[model samples]
Target: MLQIESTFDVQGDFGDSGLGKLLDMFRDMSDHDEDPGRFVVEKVIEKIPAPLRWAAEPFEAVLGAEVNDQLDALVPGAGDEIQAIAGALSDRARKFAIRSVLDVGLDAKGRKTGTHRIETIIQVFKEARLELPATELGDKLAPATRIPITLGAGEFEISEHRLKFPAGTMLSRALPRLVIPGVLGKVIESAALIARWFACADTAAKVAEKLDDPRAGAIAMTACASASKSISDQIEERLAKIDEEGRLRLEGSADEEGEGTYPAGGWRGAFRIDKEVEASIDPQRNTFSTQEQMATQ
Candidate 1:
């Protein structure tokens, strides 16, 4: 019940291991010629409780069949389209980029819990700039034509990551639609699934010691939502309205001042993870601060 309300945005490449591993899992399920159903139930759904294991049956049923082609089209080539859309949104937000890869290690016996690890890096630039055209005054005075502005550049490392998906809800809502047939159906299904995953994913990170402004948190969250929406748009324009079509809502369970948690609160729109200052930055009390940073502050 860590309810710190915020928007989360990710824009960048999914390292070879992040989304690639997920795709590999899907591909494995599809390519297991001998016993694809067993593979899904065993490798993929093994972590699910016994009673709930049946919940994922639909996913198992559809593997290694005609759906393979549709799945291929849906998740083509290490998610290039997804990265492109995220990058565009990141550029639009003027925020840092995120490079991540998630790896889940299933138990060999298919009866034990697995390990889920997410490695993420935040690529921050010291400043952002916009060039201006030379004017008569500038030509005469030799004034600078480009303006450098602060863009909240700071290094952050996600020391740990956690995923909290409602298995029942995901399976029930998305798996049913998987049988709709055609690539569009697969896209729609995948879109819903991805959106939910974004909403459910959480991270624990260390940031620059000076990064204490709540606006950074809000901006990050908003950017993350926009990034997720961009992915939805890539899948299908109409569904870009994910908030409405996908029932996407971000809720938080924290108390006033954004410092409390509610464990029993079933659904959370925002989660606040404990953070530590990984590094310290001295801006020289505005001496080294850019005009943009001063204004934002």
Candidate 2:
């Protein structure tokens, strides 16, 4: 009897076919029409606002139309009025945002959602100037002894008395899916659903305050609560639909009996594919790097 063992490292190359498939898949996942990241980015970009615009908002909350007129810039009562309203909405906005975020919806276990909502609030506070109080969260923020904590972004001061407050809008604007990278792609997908909710409460507050009706605040609160629930439900549904579509990308529809494997469908409709893989591990590069490159070559 003779025993023989044979082994060969074929290291087959995909030539052009594999590269073509990969490119097709990449294109499919990135297509604005089909991509959740694109969907979310566009939506988020709409809400992020410009940095200068963001900076102006707090001032508006403080001064309203008082700051509107150039001539009124030095009005006798201007500083007093600004001081009155500057921190007025900060606490209220924080409360409204925190409440709205907690309403994101429940998980499968019938428990409340994760900390993303709180984190969003924290991020908003950190990046933007809010009237700092002696409270715990307030203490975490960069102090603004005067008004404008930053004159403008990257230096270039405007006025000595204007305060040097900076804005987080630039950061918000920076997150849109102009290019769409890894897990951030997943975040972008949920941006529209979550982002608007972040500010809707603040908006409702602003509108109520502007109306100057004693009952308007209560009325808006009720209406906003109702509306927020509906929006949360909508977001939950949209995420579910995306997950179903994304499933096809991650591991293909399971067998009818849910046993055997089927052909892969790459990451077509999936935006959160990274969620399935470990952090620092990109599913695209791992799957297509060596094998697909060799085949494409």
- Tens-digit lDDT track of model 1 for 18-131: 222233333443343433223322433334334333543344444323223323455443133323323332232222221112111223443212122112212232232221
lDDT of 2 by residue, 1-297 (tens): 101111111111112222222223223323432232232222322333354234323333332232223212334432232222222212222121111011112346543221111112212322344322223333232232221111122221111221111112211232342212343244344433233322334544553465555554454444445554554464344334322322111111111111111112111122121134211112332111011110110
Alpha-carbon shift of residue 99 in model 1 (angstroms): 19
Per-candidate clashes, comma-separated: 12, 13
lDDT of each: 0.26, 0.26
Candidate 1's displacement at residue 27, Å, is 14
